[model samples]
Target: MPDRRDLDIGELMTAFDAVVRANASLMTQLSSRAGVHDTALRALVLVSDTGYSTPTEVAGFLGLTSG
Candidate 1:
């Protein structure tokens, strides 16, 4: 295979920064909503961050049960 040396660190950093900023904005909005405590918000964040999770796993981590 030909040498693959094609990647832009600057662009990657920019995209990462944008994602971080957007996540922060959404987190603030969600936190302001009623009936949502820190634990719930954290569970949501963890699920979103990890991209996929089972209810049992999340519940176990959050000290909740899969109902």
Candidate 2:
């Protein structure tokens, strides 16, 4: 196990935030490259979260109609 004394919560949180921002930036780039709209990318993320979602389910999650 690692030593607790070596841990800095603030620094760890900053690093985590940086990683999150970087990942978001990368996802935006990928979405743009794939010619996907922001809403479509968000729906894809929702579908991934649900593990097996239909268009209706995704639409509902996004407060949209599946029509």
> How would you encode candidate 2's per-residue C-alpha lDDT over 1-67 as one tens digit per residue?
6577556776798899999899879878989998998678878888788788986788887789745
My TM-score estimates for the predictions, one after another, are 0.47, 0.57
lDDT of candidates 1 onward, in order: 0.78, 0.82
Give the Cα error of residue 21 in candidate 2, in Å.
0.9
* Backbone Cα, N, C clashes tallied per candidate: 0, 0
How close to the true structure is residue 26 of candidate 2, measured as C-alpha lDDT? 84
The alpha-carbon deviation from the true structure for residue 13 of candidate 2, after best TM-score superposition, in angstroms, is: 1.3
Candidate 1 clashing pairs? Answer: none
Candidate 1 Cα deviation (angstroms), residue 47 = 6.3
In angstroms, give how far residue 8 of model 1 lies from its true place: 1.3
- When summed lDDT is taken over every stretch of 10 residues in candidate 2, the lowest stretch is 1-10
RMSD of each: 7.5, 6.2
